[model samples]
Target chain A: MNTKIENKLTPVRIIAFIFVALWLVIAMFPFIWTLWGSFKVQADFFSKADWLNAIFGFHTEKQTGGFFTMDGYYGSWIEEEFWRAVINTSIVVFFTVLISLTFGTLGGYALARSTYRYAFWILMAGLIFRAMPHMTLISGYLQPFFAWNVWGILPTTIIVLVAINQPFTLWMLHSFFLNIPKDLDESAMCDGCNRFQAFRYVIIPIMWPGVITTGLFSFLLAYNDFTVTSMLLSDENETMIPAIASFLGTVQEEGKVMYAVAAVVSATAPLFFFVLFFQRQIVSGLTAGAVKG
Target chain B: MKHSTFLLFSLPSLSVMFLFIAIPIVSVFIQSLHIEHKQVIIVTENCDPFGCETTTAVDTEASAKLKEKAPLGKFNGFKTYSNRMHFAFDEVGEAWKSSDSFTVFTKKLYNYPLYRALSFTLTYTFVVTPFVLFLGFLVAVGVNNLPKMFKGPTIFASLLPMIVTPLVGSLILFWMVDGDGVIGATLQKIFNDNSLSLKASPVLTWIMLMVYGIWHLMPFSFIVFYAGLQTVPQETIEAATIDGASKFQRIRHVVIPHLMPLAIFITLILLMDNFRVFEPIIGFRAEAHATSISWLIWNHLRESAYPLYNAAGATSMVTIFGVAILLLPVLIRTWRDFKEKNKG
Candidate 1:
């Protein structure tokens, strides 16, 4: 028993534990620190006189008559009208996910079900297309959109985002549809149902898990995107990430660093909850490519 | 399904991909060869008793005709690719002849925008990829060994860094590394230097960016590797232990081989992802110190009064070229798989 216990407490195990603990701290400390700092006033948060005031909130309490205050969130959400950005982000994400999934599922089902040689080439093309930096395509969109007077609107950006998201969604959903045994839909077709009816009746029910997984990733892409939205959208149509970025750029001149911090935390909050709920799907989705490959 | 049915099924995605991906690729290449139309300025000299004045105005009709002829730009034939911002062959040759020492040659090389961005991009990609993989492997092994009760929360906590929006995650780190922020202040105190700032110097900025890259991506690598670990063969480990092998020896000889393929997959994904490093630079406001190729394109698009569409196109083509080269191994593997599938 003594030897077994000592073996379990080996030096390597101890070191591993220490390293993991340290990493956990490193990974979490910045977000926790910023979250704490968001509630403080500019003086306490950015206090040059003493850094401890940021943690202790001494000046914040003195100024706001409390240790924590909601002034930063108030300023960011209400006064700055960050709600406009929030609404725009929601609209973009909703439409992007909807359009991407609709096209992706159909295309993916075709790729998985077809016996044609073209399906392989199509997937290969998608893989290459997916590897291209999105900004490359955005450059091409700028001139045409400008000439057509269609640049800098939510709808154009949404469509562009959907286009950009197609490759990844198709790839993920293709592989996922592959995993569903063909017998399910084939048998349904054997029962005198047409191909569309088989797909609609048999495959759709079983494909929800895959669709949900792909949709979650699509939502993340559209929600987290900065490059496409920032370059494509006009100022009034700015999304949350781009708005936060603009805040960062102007914080010094505007003296609203706290607002930016609060905005960062707010933007992160939804994703935090998203991960909390969808941890299993995300983990499975991420590893799916590796496992299949 | 019939061929027509298959075609119909794929039509929506195919149309979108063709219009967006395929056409844009061709357009980027074509646009790189073209330049924005220049307005024709007509200058008229008016004689007066006080002085002779020259009034210059853009010839709107001529400009409009020129624009109608070629809306994108005139055909410049790769001028943007060869200019100071891109390949800079002439300047590089001049620098090579003028500089007597290697250090001076490098300093001059850094003056070129493409080289500057390439150096940072390459360094960030190579450095971040290995460190993230190693740390991820370590975390995976550690978590795999943890008590069953601790695993769920640990995994959840680890996922936060990755699952959070990249820009927001980087911002959270950026604020902490501010001079007055907690981490920055602590570093200053530890180093006993009052003026220490991570963002003030190029080297430190690159280091911070790399750290952020690792922090943001390690969780992804970890989760994938952890899942791989679950599938590791149990019998081999038991047999190695039965043969009186140490834990380290077993891991080295047995476990690593099992995890090698997963490691390669993670590396491929990481390489593709990190090669397009843009968000962290924006979030950290590190353009002053470092810029990647994607950032260079963004700067061209955003910073200029007239968006440098040609230059952006050229840089994007270069980025695409680089990504294609980097993706060669994956492409070869995919082709092999396809061939094998057809054979079987």
Candidate 2:
């Protein structure tokens, strides 16, 4: 069987393998290079005489007598106070996910259960809203946020992020709810449970997978957001993305490009782990809408 | 469920959407009509000691009264929309009449901010969307045929580009392609041109930005298409094979039709997403060579001395209109789908 399978490996199969392997390298090389480069001193990573100097830390050894150093991460996280941005991001992501999931689950469940045309219209409105460039909404938000003096706070940014996240979350959760057999919930309703009670008791347990999937996306949205957070939050309340961006903005003059490089790797580390643990859900969550629609 | 119960369930989401989404949309349109209040500056000459000096100061009292009257700024109607940065009716007209050649006309057209951004945005959107889709479909097909053990790690690796924050992803690629960076040094050596740099010129910058656009977004399409390929029925493939269909023929006749809906779905999503391409421009620092509608709005809003809220609002309105136009077909298709389902 092994010999027969090997015999069937034609030129086309070889080409396909080669192509896939090349793409895999293309996809993974930058990240690995940057992650490794982040541990080297700036001079070594940016060495012009030899590119291998970046991979091997030759210059860094000459200066610090070490192949690797944590100085970049230290300078970024401690000296530049990237920890504050990390803290702000954590707070924002935590609240945004919690609030969006809560509302999204309830709203999505309601939409799924309802047979009325209004639900369809609401979903349609959500589709349109989701399609709008977020910056457009931010433009409107700036005025009212300024007038009301609620522009820069964490809660305000969280609320805005939640609102922006709602359409996608609702749509995802709605589909998830639709997949659950209605008979399960109807029986709970027959057992003297109110609508909310049925949802809470009958549906909530089975809804974890979908909720987790939706919550993962919400977390990603809030955590990865740059346009909204950058526009809404003030300098002091900057999140990791905007903070990293500011580093780039001034790094040319400061000769601190490695600091920004370290921060980029730092910001990407959580997402790397996120995909690792939640790969199944992330895939399902992404394709849920496409498959259902 | 009872209507009241349903309402109770959806009330939180509905109210939040209303306050944020609906209201802001209305306010964008309203704000687009108004421009910033221009201060009345008074210049006075005061003879002091040996010399007469002229000082110019904003008439604070007049400005304060103007602020009280129209706090959002003076109502400019459609003036902002037609200005040089936006529609540029006048500039276009002048360019149209005076330019003797197409190249000169385009050069003149590039002078308008809106046109410049629009040209690059449309190019990026149209170019990136189709290329990513094609590349993604190829990868999905290639990866699906990989040995099972390689599948999981391949997917995990591919997800990095799509899942990493766009700015960070672009920055990672940006650093790699910088003059002294590894990729850059290699390119310089290969070309034997020491001055070779990707970021210095417009054509190269645009290409790099497009390359970044494809690199960052192709993984999303790949994952989506990979999932889509799983649903292709095995029986159909076997039947096609039994009928003496070649691999290419089977894919063309069976798989392509099977995934057409998904293809369309991804296309719609890609169009909308690419239409608002902003982060890559910032990440690549390609603003010197290319700009998008969203970036134009950011530029207006980020003006340090005087934020052009009105200009930003107008650009926002234009972007909203563009998105709506792009969404119309998808909306119609969705509506038709709903109607067909209801009929069935």
Candidate 3:
């Protein structure tokens, strides 16, 4: 991957550089603008009078007596109680990742090790399940949940998220298991260890790299979800994504759109940190499937 | 592994899928077949100074009792499926008979809810998947040529759109394109049309959503293709170069063939992912102009006057069918590959 081929192609290199720079701006500008504007008042953030007003914070300075204001944050966090949704999201994400990974690891290991046609069929089935639009599945869950009186709770939502997450988690971890040498586990069993014992003592030690990658995705699925959590969970048990959406309805009428902008930034902050720290793992996790194919 | 051992390992995962995913699908089909019961009616005659009058009234007690006994309501067979909302078979038939051209018929058909959703869903999936692939490859190749130190930051920036919550990502863009927002206000000043609003037109709404789709989805294909670029063998490129291949020739003859498998892989994932486009619709608040099938089902369940379970279930059934159809080609290819592996 050296520049031998590209050395003579100076014109192409220039074009490539410009295109990449333009793309970087396209990718970076929205988040940058939103993050900066989240601190401004609605009038300045929107800035219908003049677009430059947004950057200068003209309305914000006039309204709040400062260039920056905590009014939106205070209004959303204290007045609207968005902190409760943040706590709910934290609990849901933690358990969903833990349970999804636990199930995915065991099942993935079994699928990878098995030399049966059923194994192939199971993986194929998981593929179909993965493609099922999660909203369609929510329609199916609502009725029975209502009948059983489990319709609006965090635990029910957790179990459903895990079920929805299982297919993907299984496929990802299954591929990881296939990458681990089969002889590693067979040698452990040669020492008189049973199947579970080999997995416990041998496989578990080396499985973290793959497990952590898979867990990050499971964390994402649970964290980014709006379909299941919004519908199934009662307002008291709502997650951050849904909370922001719910904010839009009331805040719009009250002429407090800044509160929603603040809430959106608040909800997105964790994910920003997530991508920042786990960028490498996330990239590898995404490419793992493509590489295998 | 022993069969029992495999079963033990997989049982927890299998049972949850069976309980939640599998059973609900069956329940949805059953629910789709049945519609809720209408209130029972009673007729009574009242004798008064004005003379005997006949009156019909809702039999509340009997209707409540009926509702209690069979909570799913009356057995309507496939009636719910054919009604105006889910799939208007009769309307399609009428449009077919009356319209002189296919376009005219489709224009008439878009008036129906299900067909309108299907039209947008199919268009979005087909349009977005290919554009993302092309632009993604360009970006990947561009990023590949970037200085080493800049690559990481570039990838981090690119991952933001794909990694952020789809709802939140769309909202970020939606606000930018709002009439009062920066881009929106600038456009108004530039065009000198204060009456201009992106939300006011159906075509603009569609374009806005598809553009959002491309923005959100491009990074995925970019990352995957960028990774694939790393594996392009230098020897092959050198071989092509020695044989007098142009840069374009080198890419076409060497790089593309190497990345063909990945292109197919991306196309499959992107089609499935984009086909279920729901979040952006919510994020853009574009339901007035466009609705996806997934959004349609969600609308039935949550955004209606009341939760229309049967309607929602019917749409779910259709959507599941669509997923199966989309999946068939890949499944067949995999099955063939598996058989070939076993035979050899």
Q: If both were scored by TM-score, which would come out higher, candidate 2 or candidate 3?
A: 3
Encode model 1's per-residue lDDT on B186-266: one tens digit a residue: 788889899999999999999999999999999999999899999889899889999999988988999899988999989
Candidate 3 lDDT, tens digit per residue, B1-344? 99999999999998888888988889999989888788899999999998999999999999999989999878889888899897888878988999999999989998999999999999999999999999999999998876677789989999999989999999999999999988888888899999788888999999999999999999999999999999999999889999999989998989999999999999999999998999999989999999999999999999778788899989999999999999999999999999999999
lDDT of 2 by residue, B266-324 (tens): 99989988999999899888888899999999988885576688888999999988998
The clash count of every prediction, one per candidate, is 0, 0, 0
lDDT of 3 by residue, A124-200 (tens): 98999999999999998887788899988999999999999999999999999999999999999999999999999
Q: Which stretches of candidate 1 lie over 4 Å from their true place?
A: A1-7, B49-53
Q: Which residue pairs in candidate 3 collide?
A: none
Per-residue C-alpha lDDT of model 2 across residues A71-126, encoded as one tens digit per residue: 88998999999999999999999999999999999999999999999999999999
Clashing pairs in 1: none
Ranking by DockQ: 3, 2, 1
Taken over the whole model, the C-alpha lDDT of each candidate is 0.90, 0.91, 0.92
After superposing candidate 2, which stretches have Cα over 4 Å from the reference? A1-7, B43-55, B341-344
lDDT of 1 at A48: 63
lDDT of 1 at B296: 95
Please give the ranking of all candidate structures by lDDT, highest first, separated by commas.
Answer: 3, 2, 1
List, residue by residue over A15-116, the lDDT tens digit for candidate 1: 778888888998888778788889999888877667889889998889889989999999889988898999999999999999999999999999999988
